[model samples]
Target chain A: MKIALPIKFVIICSFLFLIHQIVQAQDNEEKIKMPESNNVCLNCHGHKYFSFYNENTEINERKLMNPYFVIDSISYLQGAHQGHSCIDCHSEDYGVYPHIAELKIEPKLTCVDCHDFEAIATEVKKSVHMEAFGEFFQCELCHDPHSNKLVKSDMAELVRYNNNRCLNCHNDVDKYQVFTSHENPQLLVTHDWLPNQALHFAHVRCIECHTAVTDTADAVHHIVPKEQAVKNCNECHSENSLLRDKLYKHQLKEDRSEFNFYKSFIINDAYIIGANKNYYVNLISLLIFGLTFFGILTHTIFRIIKRK
Target chain B: MSNTKLYLYPVWLRIWHAINALCIILLGITGISMQYTNIESPLINFNSAVSIHNLVGVIIIASYLFFFIAGIISGNVKHYRLLFKGLLNRLFKQGEYYLFGYLKGEPKPFHITKEEKFNPLQKVSYVAAMYVLVPAVIITGVALLFPEMIIEKFYTMSGIRLTTFFHSLAGFFILIFLIIHLYVITIGKHPLKNFKSIVNGYHES
Candidate 1:
């Protein structure tokens, strides 16, 4: 009887140990499970004012003031990347709490991963923004992946946004003076000749005048320095002006089968004086007319002398 | 002076000539002003020059159509008919008369008639200018008017550039023709005789 009780006791103990092991295994599985959605991350990041403290400081600053911080989900939902998921950009073990130290590396995400980096880089490398900022000239500096409404935005609004970005630094008189003094203060003085100088400053984007004339506006990002800027007034003011192709649409005839020479006879809704003017044609006509007038005068003089 | 008055130009023809001449002259002035606008004190301001040029261009086109229609209907096109059978020989004779004979005070080789209003040289030059040059200028000018309507490229050059080139070239020829026409008209019995004929529909035969 004593031997049977000991064996039963051993069986009950083992059964209890097996049940405990199974429960422990289930708890570990639950602990390591991945987050269902980005909400886990956004829970802490979505707050506009949320920020973590620097290693040196214990106080939390506004996210905008913190250079290293997460984007607010509220603003991100309204951004150009609204359709994209956080994992698309994060693309790492950010699914886990306390992401690995590598996530803090410079250029944690590269634009060239999804874009034509070579073409964009070729243009941007020449830009003053790239030259002045050096290592800080990143896509995110000008274009926030969150809240970026670039492609579908109105042209005027886009211009305003781009120019305002420039004004962020330029409007600071002391900083502007420091920047300009090192470059050329004469360029700013040269703009004084323009009619309504203040209006131009207020309305026109700096790149419009500072950049080289290109076939497409997108290529205007290939900016040149002050020395290479277009100085000729006739480039924009004369007939056959460059602005004709740049600012306006050059619509070809709908019928492409046969060439019709008279296709350009329709009146434009708006006219730029020198852009559409056929000055070469007019000049040749005038020259011929002048030659005839003078020729007649000379001929008459010769005939009068012969008569005499 | 011969007192024999020939009714060469009709009233409609006279009116067309006057209007066409005015439009051409105005277009020339405005065109020059616009082209050389950088020169101080232009004949007209830049904006005014463009406005006048466009306005006169339309008027010229209208007058040209009227001239074409009226001449066809009235059988006045016969005056411009080129007799190609002996055209080269006649042209030579007319050329000799102008270059040498007229300077020596010799009489013109060919006389004006209602049916054969233009001389041999006049027939060739006027026919080429009116039928070829005038049409070319008008077509190119109209093409330039609606830049958005045409193909962007013509062969190697832009449509605008090509049209401008042809329009200018044709205008140059017309200007030369006008000068020569004025000079040739003065070669009649009196200096102002041809001018008077266009105004009054009478020419001394």
Candidate 2:
């Protein structure tokens, strides 16, 4: 009975230890399981030419569907979603071979899922691109999921990036000519009155003129028709130009006292001649002109008849 | 007494004067309209005003060049030259004549001659207006036209702002001069005497 009891105790202890080990193994397996499954999906998709042909093509015809299914692995690794696992976006059950037809996988993940949707939505709502294209305008239209390297803090780069995205569609003059009435073959001719047209074209972004000045955070996005674009030289040439609010927001004085509304005019890298006009000088000149006019008027009144 | 005719303004000077006057009047109207863009003009729209202002500014500059060339070539420049020897004394006398003497029916302090067409005060004012003020206006106007050419900054202001300020100041002085010139023309022996003199290059003294 004593031997049986000891044996029973040993057996119970061994069974408990086995159970504990099994649980520990399961916990470790669960931790690594996600990455393993992700690699399995990447096995087929990671190839440079990984794309499925449309099976329903006629006997003589062949067509490829989802031609860009292959992800540039290097670029994806360095992308904004580098931290995220494939399952995080592809939430559907992609476990089975050839991914079940009934199991609908989201074609594209929404940027709103991770970003500040409200802020983005506010600016996007006012954007002319949205006005023309409608709400279906996906974030992917400008930003590529696998290759996007946009960083908001780097302003000059961000400006160049945004401008390049616009130029992608706009640079095709023949395509643009069909829709807009401004049929000038040379686009720069539209701004012929502006001196140093080449310099302006080289330095200034199209959005600076095409966009309406709005008090909103992203005024550059709120573009207008060419007809509605700002034609006034004073808009940029004056002491309080709209560019100061849009592009040079960083240079704005934090302390109100430090800001001289009259004299505080400067652009970051390049200089705009009229944009830096002074209000105090204008006022002083006006005063002096007024005094001179008054003096002349009084003098003229005193001269009437000749004395002997 | 028989009306004595004095050959005063030459044909080139008269033509220059007429064009300059027209340009100034148009510029003044357009300039004011441009400055106060919100106020609707009866004469022309804002865009038209700006276009006309620019056009008239170019015309005024051209006329100024003509005047300069004509003055130098014709020796009419002598008429505007201030006599430094008795400049202050003559100016005081002319000033007194305009201030009190003219009102009491006194004879004129300075008489017009071929070489000395302007009185001391007239010479001083004309020299300042034509030489200093007009050139300043032209430089500033041209600067405003081609802001890109400007060096971006002057003293405490941008070159554009400084130029614009000076341009407006000069315009104001020119406008005052025009008003005074018109009033003085009416004070001649006959109401239309000076007006006829400008038209036919002869003044009745």
Candidate 3:
């Protein structure tokens, strides 16, 4: 009886200890802000948001760094990770105070991580840059993934900005013998003598040739390559010039072409003309038919009444 | 078969039907014109035609909403809800009648009642056209009008392509139905009885 009592007591104590350990473990997980493995994070956060961000993938890690701390889940997950786990890049302190900001991580990826950039860079090295600058330029020199915006330049703006800039590079007098600045009084005086055959806007400015704006001030103006600008005849030509001065009569030209081509062309334009013709003919026929029927019915009734 | 005197068409129903029919006719014409824009403009002024087309589209939308509301309030929706009992079998039977028995002068398998005005064939076509085809076309039409909103979430090129195809396919189906509907109108007691009833809001029993 005595031995049985002691054995029962021991068993009870062991059960209590096991319960205590489980409670302690739960508390530990809740209290501390430690960086966990990707698995641990995923268990708490749903897999849907985290699936694409696994750390094993290859993306850029350099541009994603923060200054103070480095627990940034986004940067860590996005950087050089094809199938990486949370623990691969992040310190255990990730869940701690302002870990993401300390890391200064942005989620933009790098091409070198997924692709063989060395091969591409080798080919790029063989280009004119190596000959001009004696060194191959990196991707960051021409393009920044985080900041690259497509710059579209208008024609008028391109002309105004580029004239002086062009002279800086192409200062050879013989190269631009035909081209002179309107700012020069001599050129303006000479320009007045000729009947304005070319439009003022049609004259290509120096800025038309210059694609790059090297300074911060130029970016403020939203300047881009001149070719992207809208081009139409109305941008330059005066209404009076088109109405009378121009030798080419657009309407006359159109009518002449229509006469010659309408019968022979089985194109979309011809079909359009055919449909228009049909519409008019059908409309006129319908009107005549309706009016004739009404007129005849009225006349018959009148005649019948008179005879009666 | 002799329950023609049991029910009368309501004024609102007749007006709704006329408006709906007219809007559909206009939509069909405009949709055809838009598709073949390279062909000459049938309505003389381009801007006027577009404005009229958009106005007609809005009218169709408003009329559909009114129809739905009226159907629910009048307890007329009950006539549309099909009993599932032997539904597939009945559908097949109805299909067979249309395929073969219809040409043989056999009596229609389903009868119209005061409670249910539509026969099985009419029920199926009406249900398919109103619930499926009509809603599909409306959704596509709305998407086309406010493309920016719809494009934000589900903007796959394939999705847009499919929507366009379904819209045109609905047009094709409506064209087929219009021909059949016209023919059916001629099948009444008199050649012009159905047309007169629609216009005058009364049919001679």
Query: Which scores greater on TM-score, model 1 or model 3?
Result: 1
| Local distance difference test, each candidate | 0.66, 0.68, 0.48
Error of 2 at B135 (Å): 3.0
RMSD (CA, Å), each prediction: 21.3, 18.3, 23.3
Candidates sorted by lDDT, descending order? 2, 1, 3
TM-score to true structure, per model:
0.51, 0.62, 0.40
Residue A196, model 2: Cα distance from true site in angstroms? 7.1
Deviation in angstroms for A242 in model 3? 22
Give candidate 3's total backbone clashes. 25
Indicate the TM-score of model 1: 0.51
Candidate 3 structure quality by residue, lDDT tens digits, B84-132: 7888898899767654565455676875456767666667777776677
Every model's DockQ: 0.07, 0.08, 0.02
Poorly placed runs, candidate 2 (over 4 Å): A1-111, A117-119, A131-165, A172-186, A189-205, A212-215, A218-220, A225-308, B1-3, B39-44, B143-147, B152-162, B184-192
Q: What is the number of backbone collisions in each predicted candidate, taken in the order shown?
A: 3, 10, 25
C-alpha RMSD (angstroms) for model 2: 18.3
Q: Which candidate number has the best DockQ?
A: 2
Tens-place lDDT per residue, model 1, A71-147, is 66655665567667667777557765446777767355756678776766777887876798675667765567765
TM-score of 2: 0.62
Q: State which docking tier applies to candidate 3.
A: incorrect
